[model samples]
Target: MNSSRGVLELPPVVGRFVDGVGTFLADDVDEGRPIRCRFLWSAITPTSCRWEQAFSTYGGRGWETNWVMEFTRTGRDCTNNG
Candidate 1:
């Protein structure tokens, strides 16, 4: 990871770092395996944000994806209350 400040910045709501765990087909062919992913938020606003993720398998090559999403605030919490 780079130590230089201001290299990446994000809003408080977007979080500085995010992590995800899942399984995906290797090369879109093989059986799914556990994958760990990390995301860094580079830009964020009240209604939109942009980030990128790096994914790595337990014993395989890594991949990445960039994402941008627009959000609308519903008066609901971000958790499963049911």
Candidate 2:
């Protein structure tokens, strides 16, 4: 886990980090193991360090970052035989 200042380095989980204009789109599709995340903070930006980066770059507080939806796949939906 690598970190600088208040930047948190969470263990990599199965997911996609899509690069947007300002914000990043995180699609957590790994149902078997959801993206478990933890974080550190900075004195200047106390609320959420990464939040600002994600919000500012992706367009800032608006209708876009309203809500995050997660989809679940059932037995048959998962074709992989493990």
Candidate 3:
């Protein structure tokens, strides 16, 4: 994943992308109930990527979830190859 400074480790295959992306989710179930979550990426490289995904469901559901994922290169190589 990308660091706080936005420096990506960038593996040999995917050394073309930068990290430092994040997502957020929030909701309210009842009159006084609120749910919220924040996610961050831990490592990122040109050939691979990793990040944390989290969510919180409050009030009615009272649910919380967290996850991580790794991605491999899936795109066809172009002439540029850079």
lDDT scores in order: 0.44, 0.31, 0.49
- The model with the greatest lDDT is 3
Q: Which pairs of residues have clashing backbones in candidate 2?
A: 22-57, 22-58, 23-57, 23-58
lDDT of 3 by residue, 1-82 (tens): 3567788542222112234554433342323455454345545668777765444554324434468778777676767785
Name the candidate that leads on TM-score. Answer: 3
In model 3, where is the ten-residue run with the lowest total lDDT? Answer: 9-18
Tell me the number of clashing residue pairs for each predicted model.
0, 4, 8
**Regions of model 1 farther than 4 Å from truth:** 1-30, 58-62, 66-82
Residue-level lDDT of model 2, residues 1-82, one tens digit each, is 2334666543333333334213333322223443323221223232222322111222323323323333334435345655
User: TM-score of model 2 relative to the true fold?
Assistant: 0.18
Error of 2 at 5 (Å): 48
Could you give me the TM-score of model 1 versus the true structure? 0.29
User: How many backbone clashes can be found in candidate 3?
Assistant: 8
